[model samples]
Target: MTIMCSAESPNQPEIIIAVLAILLTLVFFLIYKRGKSTRRSILLTGICDSGKTLIFSQLVHKKYVQTYTSIKDNVGGFLIDNVFLKVVDIPGHERLRYKFFDEHKSAARGIVFVVDSLTFQQDLKDVAEYLYNILSDDVLAKNKTKFLILCNKQDQTLAKGSNAIKSILEKELNTLRVTKSRQVESVDPKTSKTSVLGEHGRDFSFQNFSLNIEFAESFGNHNKDGTNDIDQLVKWLLKIA
Candidate 1:
């Protein structure tokens, strides 16, 4: 009679360990792909004629440059204290702004929102609307981006200071909360599903954003005042970089 022999089944612990190893390898591969997929940025954004291009030139090109209006985004970078920081100067046209912002926001590390302080009073509503759009995006909040609300043209006599701009923006944003709440849909891709800006039963404040916001006054031109100059912006860049 021939002897009948059967091999034992695999060890349950060994099977589990082998499966876990494969899963861990997959997880690491995905993480590496995600890290390599996106480009990081410090974005320059605001309404047209808000000096974004000028400021961008100074920071990235180390000179003052201006165009009547930005037609497209300007992408560049500069070394900050030996660290290279990438920047994107988005065209602030109402029609064009959203597209550029959405494209780069996934990699945004900081946002520099330029404002025309000399014309702030006249541009309040437009400024408020555009700013509201930026602040409402769930992605920026999730990234915890640093925001520099740079009130440009601070050298002008009529320019609003940082504090005034902050106060005015708060009031306008509070009112905007009511207005935006009524909109059922937004045409923009990323901002279409924006998170609610502030807590209910409370007036809107910049603090409503988890973002680190700094309202600072500066002039993009070469005339550097002690604090009312690009120094503040450079300082801000250094910290974020």
Candidate 2:
């Protein structure tokens, strides 16, 4: 008769712990990658004639072509910096923009608000309102979508630069935050707190957002020096991609 039992190794617990830690790390990494892969839509939105379609054409078709206001989203793809970008050129029309944006929002990785810098001064209010809607959206916030205020049509003589546009937008957004706060309070006092944007008592800055908000100059046409089109935009798309 024989009864034999081998004792466990001294480092058995440590080995188990290390193995578990490695597995946890790998799981997290895969989850992160999946998140990145699933979110690939880069939405282009703004008021009409802001060069959204032209930019879309330039990227997908490789030609800077003038386009009429599209009624539906002009979905396309382009490759840059070794990344394939899923660009969804949502119609800039007021009615269609929101509808299309809401449809593809689940896949949104980033957003490019194409502004006609020349008309930015006159359209400041509308521009600010549209941007406020996006910034305040629960879905956009939850998705942590990145934003780029594309100060497009910068090649024209009257067009403003990106720096000036950013300053103007910051100021406008600051005002909108106050306005929205009041509106929310009047409608529903309890929900007002959640509707507030930026710091409660401070001026709104793009920096206040946890998600990235960038501004870059671009155009969909040939410039004086013949190099002011979507080059900057392409760089931005690649960056967010």
Measured by TM-score, the strongest candidate is 2
TM-score of each: 0.77, 0.88
Backbone clashes under 3 angstroms, per model: 0, 0
Colliding pairs, model 1:
none
Q: List the residue pairs that clash in candidate 2.
A: none
TM-score of 2: 0.88
After superposing candidate 1, which stretches have Cα over 4 Å from the reference? 1-39, 184-195, 222-228
- The whole-model lDDT of each prediction reads 0.81, 0.85
lDDT by residue (4-47, candidate 2, tens digit) is 99996689889899999999999999987898789988898998
